[model samples]
Target: MKGILSGFLVVVHLMVISQTSPTDFLFPAPPNQKELTSQKLWSTQYYIHQFQSGGKIPIVYADGKPSGLFADTCDFCMASLEGTAFVKDSSGNSTIINFAKSGDSSFVNCRACKRFAASKLNVESWGRTLWSKSQGFGDGVKNYRLVPFRTIAVDKEVIPYGTVLYIPAARGKKILLPDGEEAVHDGYFFAGDTGGAIKKNHIDIFTGIYEGNPFPEVIKSNENKTVDAFIITDQTIVDALAGLHLKKAF
Candidate 1:
């Protein structure tokens, strides 16, 4: 019986490492090789929250009274979408601000009062709902909150949300995590966010903005570059990475 149990454990370990889809049974049947390998094809790009200090647009109250300036147009664009921006204060210190869309007016939360004119920033900021306050910036689809360096947006039809992926090209990259810790990429990424542009054969990596823009630069160097990717079948590893990503920290 002990020998039989040891054999069972070995089979389980092999199953976990072999990239079995979650839908598979405990003793999964063999997969179609072509279908399985097809998921390996990936085109990688990255997205970032805006962090411009030299912004040209002014964030103002609904009445058109000036409140603060955005870092730049790209900063304004991403801030509206991502729900967060790093703004330059009077003393030239960068500060974090949050935005939420409400009808014709958008609410800018940080240094100013709640109601802000959408007309000032233009029409692009009109449709998004308020960002989750508890999420620090914004939440992803469902319960998957966005994590700066750890989250990747995928076509849900291809790679389901909560799936764990391994990218060989990103394996040894080093990054400064949000909590100010320097960490090495384990090559594991969580599929937590989605975008309209994220269709088949593509994955959008979320490399959150930082003051110095250091970590983003590291990820940017690899942007638009294709790399071999694998879905991790190991439930233990998937759960660990997914849980960390949902916690909204690296």
Candidate 2:
């Protein structure tokens, strides 16, 4: 009778252990506990690339093949820090233009769409490139494909790449989705890209593309605002948010 009673207790213990969730032990809550702390908040600015159309700005490859069409005002902006552009032709088709360098000159390339012809109506040439390794088409440091709204250029020394962060102030803000539908901001951001101007305690938000106003109003509102920020160390939540950007990114 005593042996049978001990056996029953052992079986029950095993059943309890087996039924327990593995994640409960495997993934523990982060130190910050997902709460925004005053120490984590940082000043932030915004950056954007544009999908320009119906302009007289012309760009070509190093070989003089017409690359794509860009907005008239995009000449200097496209050559600046935001090293990429989405140019649209008269037919309303779009192509990616990445900045490149040839010796002492800067240029742009339509590596994605190579068949476009220059608009002959006195269009201004942005630059010319032959596609060399001296330049690239992505972010400043890691060259990770920039995803608008989700990507941020951070100071790597302060916020390393792959670190997921949450901005409490961004919560409930509405943003336009890729499908043209409006979605509320989740306050989540991924630090996958970096920039020269990004320094300690500063972050540059990538707001994707726009025609008139480069920075969206939602993002512009946060400019220069020292908002509450949180470092998400929880692997589960990190994967769900950060993975969403990395998986879709190149």
Candidate 3:
């Protein structure tokens, strides 16, 4: 009887080993050769917000007042949209294969327009007003209230619109002012906005006018300062690896 019990135990051990072994049941069958020959396909769209400064430009508005330094040639207040593509592999690795910029032609001018166009310094002066408008100037107007110091563009499917986020400084780097001082800026910015330059997980911070002046100094000073941007995401990567998508939308 002892011999029979020992034999039964041997059979149970063999069964367990077979169940766990890669050669037995642990490995799935390789994909079919013909299916493997087929290319994998994935599709995704990338978008950015088109943000225009709230001030008026020199052009005439329908209301006919001087659009100010930045005013109503459709210069400062517009939104943009562009598209991009991504590919997925059998191993579930996704990569962005192509990105293209598409949208209103007006959006391009906001970023690339010259500071002094043909001798009019509209572009230069407007940058100062942009800073001032963001820092809480121009009450009594409906659209002139200060927005937020920071604007983050996110995937609505991942992080919903109108959500407020608390952005901390970037790792190991503090925000430096023109006075050469390091300051901690902890602020809450709502997700009510978007921009052509702002991609998923990317943020564009609005710094106020340095000394009530725009143009060369304010523009030059912007080159070196870094601001903390807070963005919301659900830890899912549908296109490329998470963080900000900076590729130009086609």
> Is candidate 1 or 2 superior in TM-score?
2
Pick by TM-score: which candidate is best? 2
TM per candidate comes to 0.54, 0.57, 0.29
- The weakest ten consecutive residues by lDDT in model 2 span 16-25
TM-score of 3: 0.29
Tell me which residue pairs clash in candidate 2. Answer: 107-128
Better of 2 and 3 by TM-score: 2
In model 1, which regions exceed 4 Å deviation? 1-74, 81-83, 86-134, 210-225, 247-250
Across residues 74-121, which tens digit of lDDT does each residue of candidate 3 receive? 233221112111112234332221112222222224434443344332
- All candidates: CA RMSD (Å): 15.1, 18.1, 26.7
Answer with 1 or 2, whichever has the higher lDDT: 1
The local distance difference test score of model 1 is: 0.50
Query: What is the overall TM-score of model 1 with all chains considered together?
Result: 0.54
**lDDT (Cα) of model 2:** 0.49
Output the worst ten-in-a-row residue range by lDDT, candidate 3.
131-140
lDDT of 2 by residue, 49-137 (tens): 44435455455554556664545444334433455554445564444455553323543432212322342211122333222112112
